[model samples]
Target: MFLILFFFTGFTIIAFISFLDDIYSLPSRYRLIFQFCGILLLLCQVYYSSPYSYWLFFFLSILSVGIVNAYNFMDGINGITGIYSLILIICLSYVNNFITTFIEEDFIITIILSVSVFLFFNFRKKAICFGGDVGSVGIAFLLVFFTGQLINTTYDWKYLFFFSIYGLDTIYTILFRLSKKQNIFEAHKLHFFQILVYQTGFSHLQVAAGYAISQLLLNIWIINYSASNPLFYLPILFLLVIMHFIRKKQGLAITIK
Candidate 1:
């Protein structure tokens, strides 16, 4: 009971500030402070119940902040967040049911249904509603919590593959920006999906579907083979390398104002 209270309280804190940022365009530092506070609350819960090593907790803190911001950064187009998150939740549901029961099945179902509803409105060329920072960061935090639970239950780091698609895109984009001596925090259309949409003439739905499908395929592989053999990551790595090459080919000369 106390665990649930702490978790929800932290989520509320993050979501409330994120929603305010959506409406008022709050400063990034203010948002980060609240985000850190919320994540700290979550870490306290972890500490009280099934604590890990200090280094692991430290790494999770950094990763949590990065994922929350990455989810916000990647929410640039219609249906991407809605579709991607829906697929991810479904995959996580499968893990919860079949692989390892770390979290409640009902909770995953609720999130799955919620994302489905969001997709109904947003998964179109002309979206009726945008996720904004609130929707994106809130869902990201939930995902981090759930994924953390699963990892802690099974003690397998391979679960991190669940976030591979977004992580790859976010990390590669940051490196690309750094190579050009650009401010990594500044908004730009250099993300692989963004380049596909703005530069390659793919429709928004098309790019969104492609990303979701790619992640789904990767998840399938991870669930089936990656668990038994670590070498399975080779194919996944090869695929990501190909994606990076394609993004570079398309985005190298593009400039944003």
Candidate 2:
């Protein structure tokens, strides 16, 4: 119906405009405009007939847009996007099968097959083709939709842990940059994965594999223990501690004299 059409059409527009930007180096503001237009169209088509649902969708619209961009921001390293995306998609597919079927399982399988092929090209010493904005943002939008549907169906907020791996890195990186008085919008090699590969001398595959492994572990934990308690944030704290020590071990953190 209208929902499917709007979703695909918006995704197409954003992917197309972002692909152009990848080629021609379009201004950031113009690219944002296209992203907002696409996201807005998708949001408006949701079932928001009631006032509560309308406001809920409105809130989701803003959050989804940020997540879409965050996925793009994390796409800098080779293999990182394809690998992390594969992990998330696989976990979500599991959730669909065993826990709750918010989305079509076949659709999830299709995504898995596609990302597996992408990893063959991307998870290598030399990438054959970069995902470009189209690949990253497009996949981001798709993940957000699946995650949102799961939340809507279950009414459990803890399911947001599905994004814990990327969420931690993105949120912490933004705060870290703000504390350093850097322009958050401008691109830089500040993300944790970027630091691991660029500064620590880890190969792209190593760092990417490390992230995917860690996420796989976390997903296993989330699946075993329901994260309904407030203590669910404990796992994220452990991850932060691990990242801190990793930076220290790699000589990337500044030591006070």
Candidate 3:
């Protein structure tokens, strides 16, 4: 209970800051500071509830912040957050029920229902309102806490595949920028999904659906496979290769922007 409240309070603070930025464009340093504060709160929760491992704590803090930022970054288009978040929450709910009851089932249902309402407004031919930083960051914080609980309970690294699609795109894009000596922190639209929409003329809904569908398939695979096996990563690797080839075929220069 304390852990939950602590994380929520931290999430509210971070989201409030982000919501302000959505309107006024807050300084990057201030945003980073708030993000770090949220990270510290989550880390404190973990420390209080579980056995301490310095390395694991550090990694979780980093990963939690990364997920928060990645989710926000991917919120570039309409319907993507609603559709992809729906898929992720549904998968997590399933795992909680049939595989391992790591988190509250009610929490999952609440998020699903909330996301359903959000999807109603945003998933159509025209969007009414965006999730913005507040919506995205709040949801990301919830997911990170739930995912951390699952990992701690089941000791299953395979669960990390939940964010596989977004992680691949974000990590690869950053690396690609680094390779070109570009400022990775600068805003750009070189994400493969972005390229699909901007360069290849794919609609936002189509690209969003593509990611949600791909992730749904991956979740099904993970649910059936043994997390302890080293081969659990093979499917993600295969999908990454396919995505790479597809992007390569587009022949768009990442250096252009």
Highest TM-score: give the candidate number. Answer: 1
Off by over 4 Å in 3: 254-256
Clashing pairs in 2: none
The residue-by-residue lDDT of candidate 2 on 203-257, one tens digit each, is: 9899889988888888887777766666666777899888767755766443211
Clashes of each: 0, 0, 0
What order do you get sorting by TM-score, best first? Answer: 1, 3, 2
For model 1, residues 1-257, the per-residue Cα lDDT tens digits are 87778788989999999999999999899999999888877776755566577897777888889988998988888999999998889999998988889888999999988999989999987889878899999999999888888877887778788888888888888988898889887778888888888888899999889889999998888778746686878757886788778876775755565
Q: Give the residue spans of candidate 2 off by over 4 A.
A: 44-55, 247-257
Q: Residue-wise lDDT of candidate 3 within 6-80, one digit each (tens)?
A: 777787778888999899988788988898888778767755667758888778777878888999889888899
Q: What is the lDDT of residue 125 in candidate 3?
A: 69
Query: What TM-score does candidate 3 get on C-alpha atoms?
Result: 0.94
Model 1 stretches astray by more than 4 angstroms: 226-230
Q: Using Cα atoms with residue i matched to residue i, what is each candidate's TM-score against the true structure?
A: 0.94, 0.89, 0.94
TM-score of 1: 0.94
